[model samples]
Target: MISSYSEYKSYLEQDRIALGVRNDHFSSKIKDFLFPNYIWRFEQTLRKLEYYYNCKNSFWSKPTYYYLKYKFRKISIKLGFSIPINVFGPGLAIVHYGTIVVNTNARIGKNCRIHACTNIGASGGTSHAPQIGDNVYIAPGAKIYGKINVANNCAIGANAVVNKSFEETGILIAGNPAKKIKEIDIKKIIKHI
Candidate 1:
C-alpha cells in the first residue's frame, strides 16, 4: 500500500502518462481528469484517499478523507467496482469500469491495465488471492482466481479463465481454462501506444 503523498502523486502521473496524457495544458488535463472513458481519475482518487485514511496523519485533514470516502463509495456503487481499500497497486489502469471485482487479498503491481467485467478473486474457500505483476493487461470478461502468480508483461485474453499460475513473462494466455497461446513482445506493443 502507498504510504506517502508523493507516492500517490507519482501513481496518478503514471496512470495519466499511460493514457498518453502529458503535463501540459492545465485546462485539458482538468477536463480529462473530470471525465474519461474508464474514469481512472476517480479510481485513482479513491485509492489515494483510502491510503490517506489508513495512514492518518497531520498531512491530510480528517474532513477531506471523509468527503473522499463518501464519494468513493458512491462511485463504487455506480461503477460496480467492489475493490477494497488499499488492495490495488499504483498505476492501475481501468480500461473500463463495470462489474469488476478484485479481492482485497489480491496484490497487483504497477502499470497493470484492467478491462471491464473482470474478476480476480479466490476459490475453494482459500483465503489466498492472485498476485499479478507489472504491465499486465487483463482483457474484458476475464476471470482470474486461486493463488496465481501472473508474470509481468503478460496478457490475459478476453473471457479467459486463469485458474493457475504463470510465472513466465511476456506471454499471452487465452481460452476458458487459460493456456499460453504464444510469447508476445508486449514492450513493442506498448511502444506504439
Candidate 2:
C-alpha cells in the first residue's frame, strides 16, 4: 500500500532511474491527491482484465466474468491508462508489467524477480500452492503449478512449465516440462545488474 500520491510519485521516479529510463517528464511533488487512488483503481482494472484473458472458462462463470469486465471497463474509463496487478513479498521485484497471475495461496520468498506473462497457480484443484524460494528469477511466459517447491537461486527460463519440485541451486530450468539445463554463474548476473 502506497500511502499518498507524493510517495507514489517518488516511487515512480526511483523505478524509472532503476530501469535506466530518463525521468524528465515526471514531477517529484504531486499536487492532486486523487492521483494515487486513480492509479490504484487502474491497476485493479488491469488485473481483472488479465484474469479474464488468462483464466480457464471452467475456473470462472459467465456472470462473474461479465460483472468483472464491466467493473474494469468503468475503471479504465476513469483512469485513462491500463495498469497491472503487481504482487511482491519483501525485496521482490517485477521487471515488466502485464499478464502476470499469482495465486492467492502461493508463497513467494524474498529477492525474487518475475517478468511479464508469468502464471503461478495451484494444480489438480488442490488447496496447496507453490512455495518459491529466494533469489529466483522467473522469465516471461513461464508457468509454475501444483504444490511444488522451487529451490533457492534458480532461474526458470522463458515459457517453461514447472510441475515438480526442484531443489537445485544456481541452475537454469527450461522446456515444456522444465528440467535443469546447466550450472549458471550467479555472480555474472549480479555484475550485469
Q: What is candidate 2's lDDT per residue for 118-179, written digit by digit as tens?
A: 88888888978788886678898999999899887788999999999999888899998999
Instruction: Determine which window of 10 residues in candidate 2 has minimal summed lDDT.
Output: 81-90
Total clashes in model 1, counting residue pairs 3 or more apart in sequence or in different chains:
0
| lDDT: worst 10-residue window of model 1 | 184-193
lDDT of each: 0.80, 0.63
The alpha-carbon lDDT assigned to residue 188 of candidate 1 equals 65
Candidate 1: stretches off by over 4 Å = 26-38, 57-60, 189-193
| lDDT string, candidate 1, 1-193, tens digits | 7777777777677777665555588887787677654466566667678667766766557878888888888888888888877766666667665889989899888777788899999999999999998878889999999988999999999999999999999999999899999999876645423
Against the true structure, what is every candidate's RMSD? 2.6, 9.7
Clashes (backbone N, CA, C under 3 Å), per candidate, total 0, 0
